[model samples]
Target: MATFTPPPTDTMRAKLLLAAREEFAAVGITGARIERIAASSSSNKAQIFHYFGSKEGLFDALYAQTLAETLALVPLDAEDLPEYAGRLHDAAVQRPWAQRLVTWYRLERGDAAPMEAVVASNAEAVAEIERAQRAGVLPRTLRPAVLLGLVVHLAAFWSETSPEFDTLVTAMMPARRRQVVVDAVAALVRR
Candidate 1:
């Protein structure tokens, strides 16, 4: 049903991606403007449709890119749990858009199979939890999925609602306080 066509130039594609990201970040998917995205990207609306098929298609591509970026920040060999938590905290503060985009996707403004895509994107995180479980790093009483959900949700919750989130929870707290909270969480998780 499809015919072959020349691919859009890399520069053009990059601009469109960047523009789409900004639009989605500002107004969310339901409110995003395809025409404005095209204008800002210096491409035509037709070009966007040609490349992405539809707004949903464009969203899928953008969501995949965002997930990849998030996964990259998570080190595969998480030797130091507190250090990894610190990294996650920093990322949440610096890239709040990342979680907000996912939240928008979860709200599901008519995208096909959006839930499936989100689960698929989370495969790497699930795998990390499994590895932690086998190594006894994660509590045996908790399912890997549950534990992983807790980690992500906890970070997201603090990032979104806590007035003191960035300055207190996410920032590199003074060394003494960092240990106090890290130990507190370790105790709670182990309980």
Candidate 2:
């Protein structure tokens, strides 16, 4: 009998990313072990270093990947800020690990280079909010950047905030939590 092997490609990269994501989300970068990531991915530490250069490099790659994936999947709807916030809340709920990964990134690598994609996306969103404000759809009192930040923060409030508060909020149904996010965003942007 012959042993089988999987060819190396993006699939391997994805497996490593997924494994690393779980590890990092669970214990953060400082505490996550490359050995565990390797074992989980059916890969080895050498491959991880070869692909990402180091543990920090792997974390950077994973952070970039997570941000891009989230932006692509849960795009902002400038035409409807409340709906956009609701969708963001839904995305946070559906991919709870993603918010945790982001939390880990902030805690572990606060001084790292900003993800350019996220910066550009935020710029675009700010521009859209500005347009909406000028068109009288959204209130002009608040700065566009501030409005965007508020909506984004509202969407991830429970996940990124205090664990004790999160436990209480989690007791409510997901729909209620989502509604709260949407309502908060709506109130902020209301004329």
Candidate 3:
């Protein structure tokens, strides 16, 4: 007979974390139901507590993980700001999870700890921007945080949200117009 080995509990807990991220991104923490999150992970509420201590604890873990993951996606190379911009634009187009997680965090304001993840991530990006400015790749006057903000906040408007936004971008705008808008933003960042 083949021996059977159970998957590690941490592995199961990790699944819960991922499910929580998706759920919180969709529903916001206030609106996200624990049962649904559990159902998605094929776990129960008791297991959630065992892993995270509580729903709020689960939210904190999700928020931290989401911030870390999103920050990891940022391209901070001085020579590759354009590529970075393109990457960010593509992320907005491709991975809506980061934006949704951020939206949920902003709306819920659930984390009790200081937003250290944000400051750390931005600081690293700022260091990279400073390098870009020194290299004359980015404009000397552009603040890294401001540039990052523009990339994230503006791209988010187009990428996420109501059906109206999708209709306007998908059905209303001509292909040329859509391309033009994207090009304009890229040009603004490059200049």
Would you list the C-alpha lDDT of every candidate in the order shown? Answer: 0.69, 0.87, 0.71
Question: Which 10-residue span in candidate 2 carries the lowest summed lDDT?
Answer: 161-170
Off by over 4 Å in 2: 1-6, 166-171
Better-scoring candidate (lDDT), 1 or 2: 2
Tens-place lDDT digits, model 1, residues 12-103: 77788888888887788879989999999878899889888988778778877887787788653433444555556567667878777777
All candidates: CA RMSD (Å): 5.5, 2.0, 3.4
Deviation from truth (RMSD, Å), model 3: 3.4
> What are the per-residue Cα lDDT tens digits for candidate 2 across 132-179?
889888888989999888999999876677867777666788778789
Per-structure clash totals for the candidates = 0, 0, 0
Instruction: Specify the highest-lDDT model's number.
Output: 2
Model 2 / residue 6 / CA error / Å? 5.5
Ranking of candidates on lDDT, top first = 2, 3, 1
Best by TM-score: 2
True-structure lDDT of candidate 1:
0.69
**Runs in model 1 with CA error above 4 Å?**
1-8, 76-79, 109-111, 114-118, 162-185
Model 2 error, position 22 (Å): 0.4
